[model samples]
Target: MKGILCTLLLLLWMITGCSNNSASNMENNKKLAEAVKQETEMPLEMPTDFNFMVSFGYGDVTKNVIDTYEGTVTKDLIIKGSATAEILFTADELRDIYDKMKTIDIMGPKELSKKGNCFQTPSNEDLWKVTVGGETKTFSWTDQKCGITEDANQLRELRNYIQHMVEGLEAYKTLPEAEGGYD
Candidate 1:
């Protein structure tokens, strides 16, 4: 009878351990799912009339702000337009492009341009090369050890940056309209 009880107890313990592990795994999976959903839901907004330059290189990431300096070309008058926030990136981010050029082999030379606005390349490889206005910038992987590794943190940062630019552009677009003119 003692032997039977001991065996039964051991079996119960093993079952409990397995169940706990499964529960932990399920929790982790749920968290991951939520994170992914949030990321996907993040919006990428761009201005109606602006450009952004981003660079993801080994040195520094650079984002050049570019905008059309519109001027009213009347019969004999030229009025300078206002400045707007184009796009922003760092130089280091641009350099990363060369480091992982191999992964971008599938990309074509067709520039990702938008009508009357800016351009943003689709996420490819581990790099993000985007252009706004007439300027261009790059975004490369920071963690070399995780190169090619689709880490959630890296993705989140990239997404945040893009989203930020979108918001800036959106705000910029409204500025001129609100003033009823760009002077």
Candidate 2:
């Protein structure tokens, strides 16, 4: 009878211990989830002295920022497809772009790696210049290898975001389209 009682007590103790550990594990999971939620909800801050320019086009025909309020975009044509106009950004928009750049650590790479094999001729180049505080960084990358690298992909996405914003502006809409095509 004593042996049976001891076995019953041992089983009960094991079950209680397991239940306590399970409860502790559940609490830990909840804490982890909350931390992740808070982190994702946090907004990224933009630098005070931020200025940036991103441009892209085929071959030598490209676009560039002339100043804070003006830029030019040349089409992929052999003749007369360039349009110079206002390219302005609001504080909130600039902050959003800066946040994305920071998230990808754009300034971290001096040159993006050309990892995969690329045999095709050069088709396009995308350029970026960012100034924060007193430091300025400029980099250019081609569409060679179809932007296979992680850095290239991220930059492409950033460039696309900028392009979408610019194209939606009234000033950009007023620009003339290309009249000719490359040979």
Candidate 3:
């Protein structure tokens, strides 16, 4: 009887341990699935008609120009938009532009020089700016006829696109050399 009782207790303990491990694995799998889903849901391409303008001012001369640029939100990073200008700069140029624009240095009104991620004028005009190399550019609604609120949705989308691009670039930089391989 004693032998039988001891064997039965041991079996029960083993079964409970197995069950606990199974539960833990299931929980881990669930978390992993959620992470994967979130990553996969990120759009791989930027939405159509993602247009923004960049205006530059030097002393008394201020030039406002418009560029129809496209963007992509890849699993690795987000690309807001690229200019159609003939001047082609490498990836480094793009990164420099991104870094400069992420802050509100030359975008804000002349009165308020405070730095920010995005800038807004007193007239409720919102502008996004970026600097490449030493040149600073500002982007705002060119029409000047339509209010910023009119394109609020589009601006919001652009903001999200920028965020994703920044995150992707950061992730790519941290990846191991073996994973990226020689390109």
Candidate 4:
């Protein structure tokens, strides 16, 4: 009887030891998967010559931002099958946008799309994207209400700011022809 009891204790010890080993292996595998994803992803950069780009759909009436700038900006818009319009956009604006966006944690994977049931929630939602250093980060909210989380306010502000920037373009033409426009 004593021998049988001793054998049972040894078996239990072995089982616990094996489970701990399994847990460690799982943690290592998770880390490896994250490293692989980072290594394999394609890099995105904001091109210096990126004079014009569509901000995509986030507004009610106007569909896209149009560029009146000549050279690569014009050609790219044409290729995208859009009728370009002359508007005020400057490197300063881009830099400002970059500064605002760099504060958001966009280095990790993020879900940019959200779905809502019409019956469940009658609220309107919009997705905003800002591209910098060739990378685009997206934020979406229902109407202008952002969300219930702490981070939602920051997101709402950024969205409102971008909306203002895009809307502000309508007020002026060619940015008063600054020294070398893009400079």
The candidate maximizing TM-score is: 2
The Cα local distance difference test for each model comes to 0.39, 0.68, 0.40, 0.47
Q: Write the per-residue lDDT of candidate 2 for residues 47-163, one digit (tens) a residue.
A: 566777766766566653333423443323246646677666788888888788878877665347575776445556777777765567788787666554668778878888887
Tell me model 4's lDDT, rounded to 2 decimals: 0.47
- Colliding residue pairs in candidate 2: none
Clash count for candidate 4 is 6
Expressed as tens digits, the lDDT of each residue in 1-183 for candidate 1 is 999999999999999999999999999999997776554331233323332223322222222222222211111111333334443333443233222222332122323321333322322222454443333445444433332344424443554554454444444444333223212
Clashes of each: 33, 0, 5, 6
Q: What TM-score, computed on C-alpha atoms, does each candidate reach?
A: 0.28, 0.64, 0.26, 0.47
Q: What order do you get sorting by lDDT, best first?
A: 2, 4, 3, 1
* 73-99: candidate 4 lDDT, tens digit per residue: 111122233344445557788656545
Worst 10 residues of 3 by lDDT: 73-82
Stretches of candidate 1 exceeding 4 Å from the true structure: 44-53, 56-139, 142-183
Cα RMSD to the true fold for all candidates: 17.2, 9.0, 19.9, 9.6
TM-score of 2: 0.64
Q: For model 1, what is the C-alpha lDDT against the true structure? A: 0.39
Q: What does candidate 3's lDDT look like per residue over 1-183, in tens digits?
A: 999999999999999999999999999999997776554332233222223343322222222122224232212111222122222223654544444433332322333233335533322233454433334445453222333343443443444444444445543335333222111
